[model samples]
Target chain A: MKWQIISSDQALYFHSWDNECVVYNSLSGDTHLLNLTASQILLKLQQSPTEAITLAKLVPPTDQSESHAEHELQIEHLLAELNALNLIEKCQSTINYNPPSCR
Target chain B: MNISTLTLSELGHRLKKAGMFLQTGTFITHLKTSIPSVAEGIRLLYADYPLVEHLDFADFHVSLTYPRNLRRWLKPQIQFLFDGKPPFKPLPADQAFPMLEWGLNWCVSSHANHYLIIHAAVIEKGGYAAVLPAPPGSGKSTLCAALVNRGWRLLSDELALIHIGDGRIVPLPRPISLKNQSIDIIQSYEPDAVISRKISDTMKGTVAHMKPPANSIIRANETAHAGWVIFPKYQSSVPAQLKKLSRSRAFIRIADNAFNYSLLGIKGFETLTGLVDASQCYDFTYSSLENAIETFSALEPPASSK
Candidate 1:
């Protein structure tokens, strides 16, 4: 999975691990972990206005046959939790949801 | 006597309407603002608070103007315009533009009577406050922003006001300001955080304000006894570490960060010395908020026998 560098300078790189649905910042010599689900939803949202499958595509399947429905439901629950945390912002327009400004 | 006495709802309406209100124990200010957007912004920021009239310390009233000229020359006018009895120093004639309003509030109203203010971040749990005093570019704001987003109650993100007399911390609980990368770091960490519009092209790069946590606002007037004074420096890759600092060394370090230490003369020294006697001092170097938070959470009061 590729990690996107959202913010970085000479000493620190804040990146999102799309595969793990986590955000981490590497600085000086330490790596800090951010909320997992929030990181995932944000990356998914960044890709496009993803529905359930779009998120599941980023993660591995628990079971071949049930992966589709299970992942969809999980994404729904994840989105709710993220919303409560103010991580995945809501948008009025159907087209896109621009993330809030950095810091 | 303090404006904080007002309920959040009252403060919201008065600031939006550009009305006059009381503050602190003295001084009166009348605000006059025409910008509807700025009006709404102020309203939302003071949401649920009573009008500024509730402040007890000052009797001053201010009227703010919208699209308001945020010029540097207005500092002195603002200082004089919000004057009180028995005479106060006139506002300095020269200053910088789009100057931070709440930052000034922390300097003037903090409970500390002796020490000058240090631009820094503070978070307290169990009465101990970690004071992150860093010059700009030290990643202090970024680390402070992340910690407060998690669970720490923000004492402040820009000003650490230490009381000189008893060494207690005066709670100013103002909004947190983030610039450039920090803004993004916070959004990634906690999406729901309420942030203000970005004001661009400033000397410190782009800037925006984070609404202080709701609970902090309610307790803004509450003061905390200084427990541990931890000066944090955030370097990206280092493991979290805390080192004890001698009281004499702490005094020197704190004085370097102070805003008006020289102005207060002996009172400032006495106030700082008293604070040192009451608190434990340390230097916290870290790249991990988790370790930092855990270390802070596990701190035993200096009085605890171990």
Candidate 2:
């Protein structure tokens, strides 16, 4: 319902639609559609103060009943991949999402 | 006259009236049109540049002739004049005349004696030239037309004449050719801009020519240092963005886009390489002309003493 916009030299808006996660560059008309787990991790990071731990906590729960643990692992896995892609930064175990500015 | 003789005779007659010679290797078409609009188009397109001098006689004369097409279609034994110089193989009579005429004009007059001719739109500001080279439908012409009207000097909107000796961009200052929607787009965007009458039903689709900036026309022979080699793509609703391109990659891309690079061989390669080394390259995409103008005006060329 709430659209969280993260702005720096460039701005990236994060939103969820039909449970799909979407990341879009507001300036260049470039859009990236993310999977449910990845989007959730990014969304959780928007508010999470403890970047690494919060990402670990946002993973999908291990079981339908153990939803919390499953969610935590899913979030950690997605964060690791996004971090590898250089789309996010981990500062002293805290992760930050940054987008490109003009060239 | 035989068909071969007819081609020569027709070319000679038209060149005489046009007050320009049909070089031995060149081919030209002679068109007699009563349309004042067509004559206006010629003046708008070629009036300023010394290389594109217009004849005072008729309303206008259009010539189409080429060399490579001749060599491909005819054997080496055939003789033809190129630039009024030596004898070269002639192109087949069946080939398209308009393209050849345009191509020969490109090959002979352009300062790129060593490099292949690039079909591009170039504009100058701040002592450097912005080379806008793109495929059809890429809006290069639209951006060029807009810039020329906005006080940037028009280097060229169709051919970039890169000087082979010094690696500088030789100013052509020719008319800007607008196709399809760009004609109206430019007119509406720049109401004060002077544009020629639109000629419809041409092979390249509905086309119009925009007058070169007065300053550009006056200093047609002045050259600018290579500044930016920008490849532009226009898309609706997209904001302007310039992406840096690698020099090696840019060289290959530009060479691929050139019309006569291979014809000039090693000279072409060296000229393009020198240009790439001296200039910055980018991939620019934008839908709004306003945003494009702002982005270009703000661009800071790399800091280096010339």
Candidate 3:
């Protein structure tokens, strides 16, 4: 399924240093410290609604020996966590779709 | 005129009647109280602070008064009033001075939104500010008192006020509060330290405030750029050590310690980011104040200073 930020009007302020990022969500008044992969995923999705495959492609691989399937699984897990945090949600178009394609 | 110039009786009269206006760093406070100990505390600890003129506007107008009716005779408790409304529960009449200090802290922490206030001890040396943001019982105030006595200028003992526009720290120098054994620790550490009388069994367990140094009060208006952000942890018998901290971690830690980071929202994030960007962050642990002081004293000046 495609995912997009919950509130585009409420901007997320990001500050990155040494492969880590501190993200502040204005809407929730929450601050989160994210590692490089999580930060990159959020930054990419921030531009527009994106598919899980597209976000996974944007995340620079941390392990060179990891298989494509493992990487995709990791991306799905990260998306779930971020979704729970209310940083992003499933795109409106896919909310009621059967067998979400992104999965 | 400075507060020290006033006679004790005159100060007491002013406090009881028209209120005593005193300037501590950037804010002027109009303090009114009929309580004698509160006047005496101010007379002893804040003697060096300037006396604000009667006509001048004050940032906070506070009062400490005994509660009326049967409780007045039974327990004789005192209430802290800010702008004519009591914000805290009444405490024993003997604890009036500490209540004033805590009430003022509440006033600033709750109302001051233009600056990002961190629950930290800030001191300046070589024109660069070092922010020590630590939790309670970390010996932060003890370390702060020792540093101020040993050539460092105190910016504030509890609150580190950072301007949103420039990321510079505005000095809010005030007394360093020592609780429990730390009060005695500071006394032995600095024999000449001017600390208030210990008020025991209140809430925080044996609280006393060490008078800020004369030079720090004189230079209260001076601001410094943040050069270091240190999170200090005090463990008995452990050797003093400094570990480098990442900027991201420092940002998170500072935001956690901030009094109004979430209240300030995006502005708080930007202000903290700029501070971490300009500072060399560290996690400092010390068992000995001597070792910690030496380590901070030997720190290299920020690159900008060079």
Candidate 4:
């Protein structure tokens, strides 16, 4: 399944200090504090939709980062969490950029 | 003209009839009430606030009066009316004064969208302001009272009104509300501090208000840049300490403390981002007011926050 930031007219804002990032979703009127991995995944998804495996490849590995399989698992966890927060949406493979998973 | 200039008789006469136009900071409120406690509380606490004479407009037209029900006789209650319509369920008659204070706060936070209002106590010194955002019983008001008694200028005790345009703190120096043990603590801490008669058994439990420092009231129009965003917590016998806070974490905490952050939408996010960017954030835990005062006094605004 592909993932993308939930499309909204309102903009998303990010502010970081000491590597901690807080994302404000103007669309949902919600604010979330994200760790580096989660923030990086969301930032990549925000640019455009991509499947879980491709998203892991897009984010560079960190010093204490887990292995590739574990990285994909973390991405899946983050994507599910973000989607539940109304910050991102799940897209199907053959989609014309449309959300079919619990849209 | 200040409220002190009007005798209690004249103040009552106006309040009963045309209502009094009182100005706090830039907002002018047309206040009407025949409730003696409300009148007396205003007389005692708002003596320094300006009485807007010859004004054609007021920001909020509010009144505290009795509900025309049986409770008005048995366990009588007071209702807050804005523009002649009651917005809150009637509170106990004895809570009239605090009801008025809370009502005024509601007025600003509910309708004053021009500002990015936060649920914080802001005090200023040396041209910089510290925004204290803490939940109830966190000693924010107690610390605010102590700081005001010292050299700090009181911007606000309950609301931190941040100017959206320039990100400066617009002063709303009203009476500081102290609850429970805090009342006696402040009285002992500053014997000269003018506090209202303690009213007990309300929503907040034995509450009283401390008059803002005269110097703070006189300097109400002066807006200061936010230099510190400190979340203060009070515990018994704990020594005062300030720990650095990440700006992103500070953003989330302060946003959670805001009254209309979500209502302001993008403006709230942008304005708060600017505020956090220019502020040195900290988590301050203290027990002794003296030590807290000394610690706060020693703080210099972040040199680069500007």
Measured against the native two-chain assembly using Cα atoms, what DockQ does each of the candidate structures obtain, in the order listed?
A: 0.01, 0.01, 0.87, 0.76
Preferred candidate (lDDT higher): 2 or 3: 3
Deviation from native of the Cα of residue A35 in model 1, angstroms = 47
Q: Residue by residue across B11-40, what tens digits does model 3's lDDT show?
A: 999999999887777888889999999989
DockQ of the two-chain complex in candidate 1: 0.01
Candidate 2 residue runs with Cα over 4 Å from true position = A1-103, B1-38, B43-112
- Model 3 RMSD to the real structure? 2.7
The 10-residue segment of model 1 chain B with minimum total lDDT is: B89-98
Better of 1 and 4 by TM-score: 4
Pick the winner on lDDT between candidates 1 and 4: 4
Across residues A1-97, which tens digit of lDDT does each residue of candidate 3 receive? Answer: 6877766676677889999999888888898898888888888887777888877777767888888888888988988988887788887554566
Give candidate 3's error at residue B242 in angstroms. Answer: 0.8
Best by DockQ: 3
After aligning candidate 3 to the native by TM-score, how far in Å is the CA of B228 from where it should be?
A: 0.9
Task: Give lDDT: candidate 2, residue A70.
Answer: 62
TM-score of each: 0.58, 0.55, 0.95, 0.93
- Arrange candidates by TM-score, highest first: which order? 3, 4, 1, 2
- Can you write out model 4's per-residue Cα lDDT over A1-103, one digit (the tens) per residue? 6787777654577777676788888877888998887888877877777889998898865645579898888788888998898888766545455454323
Rank by DockQ, descending?
3, 4, 2, 1
